[model samples]
Target chain A: MPQVNMTVNGKPASGDVEGRTLLVEFLRETLDLTGTHVGCDTSQCGACVVHVDGKAVKACTMFAAEADGAEVLTIEGVAAPDGTLDPVQEAFHQHHGLQCGFCTPGMVMSAKALLAENPTPTEAEVRDYLEGNICRCTGYHNIVKAIMAASGQDVSKIAAE
Target chain B: MYAFDIERPTTLADAVKLLAASDENQALGGGQTLIPTLKQRLAMPEVLVSLTAIDEIKGISEDDEGRLCIGAATTHAEVAAGAGKYPALAALAGNIGDPAVRNRGTIGGSLANNDPSACYPAAALGSGAIIVTNTREIAADDYFEGMFATVLDEGEIITEVKFPVPEKAAYMKFEQPASRFALVGAFVAKYADGVRVAVTGASEEGVFRWSEAEAALGSNFSPDAIERLSLSGDGMISDLHGSGEYRAHLVGVMTKRAVAAAG
Candidate 1:
């Protein structure tokens, strides 16, 4: 086992983990931050998306040892300390962005990264950026709408609740 | 994934020395493809030498000859943002897997693994890029051997890749919906002297140069130039996604599309 240290959601965290331990496993099992879901263990399903050094990456695809001494942001750290929801979460709530909610954490993380890069992305851009985050229940209609709304764009043109 | 010892060396020399130290050591670049392979028990390496931390192999720049020089550890996202000099190559990097994948997956990793349907192979072969390793430089033609295979010896690390900018170029891929990998893809690059057409994803022999199409387009430089040209299905990959004949047909279609786009 290797001792790895990283900043998780603004907190310095350290743990002893196997070389093959995935970053997702370290976050969920070791650090007890289960907000980052793993919908598919494979890299295709972006359900394990997290921000490592300001860039969104699949947590399940990277090893914990590889992320040592890095800054990592998970779904648990998205909102304010006062428990107020972030704009993306608020929009998701308002727009019904999730149904079963298995994929909301990843969808939100991916959307946050997208909005950070392109503050005013078009509808097509939003759809394109979320290609990795798959929402099987919502059909992605409301997820797109929520992301657009989070970017302070007009989401009325998007259909559905 | 099976248990293994991991080493993250900040210097390229140290990384190379560690890889050379043990026969079971495997180099890890981004680990986008290799990690998945390891999870399936496909490979068992005793020491995993990670190369992402090496500063020497992590940037995009252009040399005096105007060729694009990309470090091996440079991520796809970095290439997508920095490789503006080569728009076709940048576009291919941008559409590799997805946003997250683009953020983590590196060009060196993609080229080293040499997945048959990988987009970089087409770009490298089409542009006549040179792969610079720790030991020496290898032409794209000599680098790729076959599916999941390359000419790189153990402990030989790809430090950088130099790509010759073409006058006009484009890559067109018919993606397999599930994996987003090219079912059949073609990269068309037109230079001053000649044209190169590299095809991937459709061949059992891995990425290959479509010389007939290249010869036809070299003179005329248009989709109609290779309209009558066709490929044999003898060495084509046939899976549930497509048949050998279907993929063979797609090669022509993608090549035409690539030429039209480049033109």
Candidate 2:
């Protein structure tokens, strides 16, 4: 087992993980943070997307050990301290970005990461950026709208207050 | 995935040594492809040498001669963003699968794996780039031999890839809707010496230069010149996403677009 020490969801965390343990597996199985779903073992599906060092990555495509000493933010981390939804999350709810909610966690996380980097993204840019996160339910029309709406909002000010 | 040992080395030399020490060891870069393969049990390496910690293999730099030296471990996002210094290369990088894939996938891993549908091969092959490993520098022409094949010796870690600033270049791809990997992609470069056209995602033997198009475009670098050339389905790869003939058609179409974009 490889020893891994890193900050997960703004908290210091450590564990001895098997070499074959993927970051998604580690988060879901070990940490019990099951919000990050595993829709496809292949990297094509962004259902296991998460933020590693503030950059969105496919958690299924990364080993738990690879995230050592790195900051990891999951769907859980995006919520407010009082458990309220983040702006991106609220935007998704308001815009009806999800239907069955199977792909909601990954979609919300990907959008959060996107807005964190680019607060204001064009429609084409949003579509291009979210290409990795697949949504079989929504057909992506409303999800794109939610992202654009969230991008225009002042997330920092909302988070601060 | 089966159980194995993972080693994260801090230096390139150490990573190479680790890979060299074991025949069953595999070097891990980005893990965008390797991890999924492992999860499917297609690859069962006894040991994995992680390259992320090696600082020497992770940035972009330009020399006095305008040649760009990109660290092998530099992620696609970095490449896409940094390739602005080299517009064609950046544009090519930007067109890779998506932002998430770009954020994690690295040029070194992509080149080392040499997937037939991968975008980087067309760029590396079209640019006539130089791949510098820890041991020696290998010309791009000599580097890729076949599908998922390269001349890289075991334990030889790629440090960086050096790309010449082309006089003009562009890349175009018809991506597979499901996987986002290219169904057919073409990269064209017009250097001071001559024009080179490399086609990927269309051949059974992996990325290969389209000699017919290259010959016609060498004299007249134009889309009209390439439109006259013929690309057939003979010996092409056929898969679930696209048939060999369909891929061949895309190759020509993408080549025309790429050549036009290069101008």
Candidate 3:
């Protein structure tokens, strides 16, 4: 087993992981960070999305050993140390972005990454960027609105939930 | 996925040595496809050699000949950002899978896998790119064999790919929404010499060049020239998503769209 070391959520995390142990497994099992859901073990569902070196990546598709010595950010890290939700999470809460909440964590993580890259993304850009993250409830309209509102855009004129 | 030992080699030489030490050691690139395949137990390698840490093969540069030289380990996102010299190639790389997938998947892995529905093979074949490996450089023409196949030898690693910038080129993919794999994708590149048309996802034999359409567009560089040239359904792939006839029809439609878009 390879002992993987990474800075997760501003803290150092180390664990002995098998070659087949996915990053999602290491986060959920070893670190007890179950907030990163694994909607699909396959890479299709981006529910396991997390920030690896400031870029959003599907944790399920990457081995724990592959992210060795990297900086990771998970859903659990999205909230401030003071217990305040991140702007993206707050927007999702206000806009009813999630239904079952299974995909919320991944959605928030992916939305953060998108905003970092393109601060003022259009509604089309938000929809396109969320292509990898699947929302089973088909609750994409609110999700898009939340992402847009998180970018400080007005979602009031947009369709209501 | 089965249990295995992974070695992350920082240098290409070390990676080659590690792969040579064990014939069962497989080179892992982006893991976009390999990891999923491993999860399904489709491939069982004794050891996995990761090529991501190798800085030698992880950037995009242009040679003196104005050709785009992309390191094999360069991620699709890197290519999407750096290959602005080749707009068509950049667009193809940018639209691969999605943003997160593009961030992790590499052009080298995509080319090495040569999935029948992949978009890179079409771009490479159409642009006549040179695939640079650890030992030798192989033209895209001789590199791909068929679906899920390539000419890569055991323990071989692709180091870089060189693409000659064409005067005009574009890739239009009709994606199979579920997998985002190209159901029918066409790449058209027109150079000073002639035009090249490569089609993917539709053929069972893998990515192929439509010579008749190329010749038609060589004289008249427009969609109208190749509009009358119909592709045959003999070797087209027929699955639940589409029939051979449907794919064959798409080949023409996509090629025309690519030509128009390139113009």
Per-residue CA lDDT of model 3 for A22-109, tens digit only, reads 9999999999999999998889989999999999999999999999999999999999999999999999999989999999999999
DockQ of candidate 3 (2 decimals): 0.89
Kindly list the per-residue Cα lDDT of model 2 for residues B1-263, writing each as its tens digit: 88888999998878988998889999999988888788778988989999988999999999787889999999988998887767988988887877788888899999999998899999999988999999999999999999999999887888899999888898998888877788899999998888889999999999999988988888998899977667788878998887888888888899999989988
The 10-residue segment of model 2 chain B with minimum total lDDT is: B226-235
lDDT of 1 by residue, A68-121 (tens): 999999999999999999999999999999999889899999999999999989
TM-score per candidate = 0.99, 0.95, 0.99
**How is the predicted docking of candidate 2 categorized under the CAPRI scheme?**
medium
Better of 1 and 2 by DockQ: 1
Summarize candidate 3's per-residue lDDT along B82-139 as a digit string, tens digits. 9999999999999999888998999999999999999999999999999999999999
TM-score of chain B of 2: 0.97
List runs of model 3 lying over 4 Å from the truth: none
lDDT, model 1, position B234: 86
TM-score of chain A of 2: 0.91
Using DockQ, give the best candidate's number. Answer: 1
lDDT of the structure predicted as candidate 2: 0.88
